[model samples]
Target: MQCMLRKQAQLWEGAVLTTVGASKLPKRPKVLVWIPEIGDEAIVRIRIRKQNPDLATGDWLLLSRKTDEMRQTLALSTDKKSLRFLE
Candidate 1:
């Protein structure tokens, strides 16, 4: 089966070739990103602030863990309460 994990966000990193969908919270959804890590692409989810137009399956977003949350809409949410992987 494909990997799925919920972890805290780090710096100097980002995700692409992504898909966004409903998360535990109706507002901030889980995102599927192909991240290059440890010589492999680890599928990671970094929760974010709600989007104007929420992303759907096959939708693409280039998010950065290092970017300022307010400045970068794709910046990962640091709120411990809102971080998780879901449908």
Candidate 2:
């Protein structure tokens, strides 16, 4: 018989991201961006007063954490919901 071990996954910081999306609400969806990256899907939490409303399915954006000053490039989401990662 053979035995295998599983490895733990790394965790990311969560933030209150503000962006625009396709929804019926006046304000954007309140989403928790844990590991936002280029080409990843995300939801909006605040209304972008001056941001463009012309977003596509593969559009990207820069996201940042509240504790860190570094901003990460992430994929914008048309679906209004929280962001999550898969194993």
Candidate 3:
């Protein structure tokens, strides 16, 4: 599912709330993101490359699938707001 990062909240561990847009409804479903270590690695690389310590909000993430409770993050928006994925 495709979702847009809305906000990040710290509750016990870091949690990101995203707005899921899959239908035309007044209420958009909000889900807590379960980011894995692999995804975190990419995020860290982006931060280091851009030299921005802060996490980027409003970024888009495309999740491909889930396996054993781990969601596979397929693609992510760069600091320049461009999409990039593993080829």
Candidate 4:
């Protein structure tokens, strides 16, 4: 049941028709995805090395429940892989 909850807790943002937010390529060569609605007062930011995410400003993404808890300058889930990208 715990596993099921994990799957169910995943939060997918945006759709093919609607985009959540666009990715930002920092000068430090990192991909940062920032979302504010689902997170606390501060925005939720996910970081990835380089442009591996290959995401743009209007790309949608899925964030794990764990990710939300560790928001505010966090780089997404670290306990387990919990992000899903739209194809």
**Clash count per candidate:** 0, 2, 0, 1
Supply the TM-score for candidate 4. 0.17
User: TM-scores, in order shown?
Assistant: 0.16, 0.19, 0.21, 0.17
Give the 10-residue window scoring lowest on summed lDDT in candidate 2: 1-10
lDDT of 4 by residue, 6-69 (tens): 6655745442233354454222222234444346322232333233444332232334333454
The candidate with the higher lDDT, 1 or 4, is: 4
Report how far residue 32 has shifted in candidate 4, in Å: 10
Q: Model 1: runs farther than 4 Å from truth?
A: 1-42, 45-57, 67-87
Q: Pick the TM-score winner.
A: 3
lDDT at residue 50 of model 1 (Cα atoms)? 41
> Which of the two, 1 or 3, has more lDDT?
3
Ranking by lDDT: 3, 4, 2, 1
Candidate 1, residue 80: lDDT: 24
State the lDDT of candidate 3 residue by residue for 19-71, as single tens digits.
66767434322223344534454564465447643534345333343434555
- Which residues of candidate 3, in runs, are more than 4 Å off? 1-53, 70-74, 81-87
Misplaced by over 4 Å in model 2 are 1-25, 36-64, 67-87
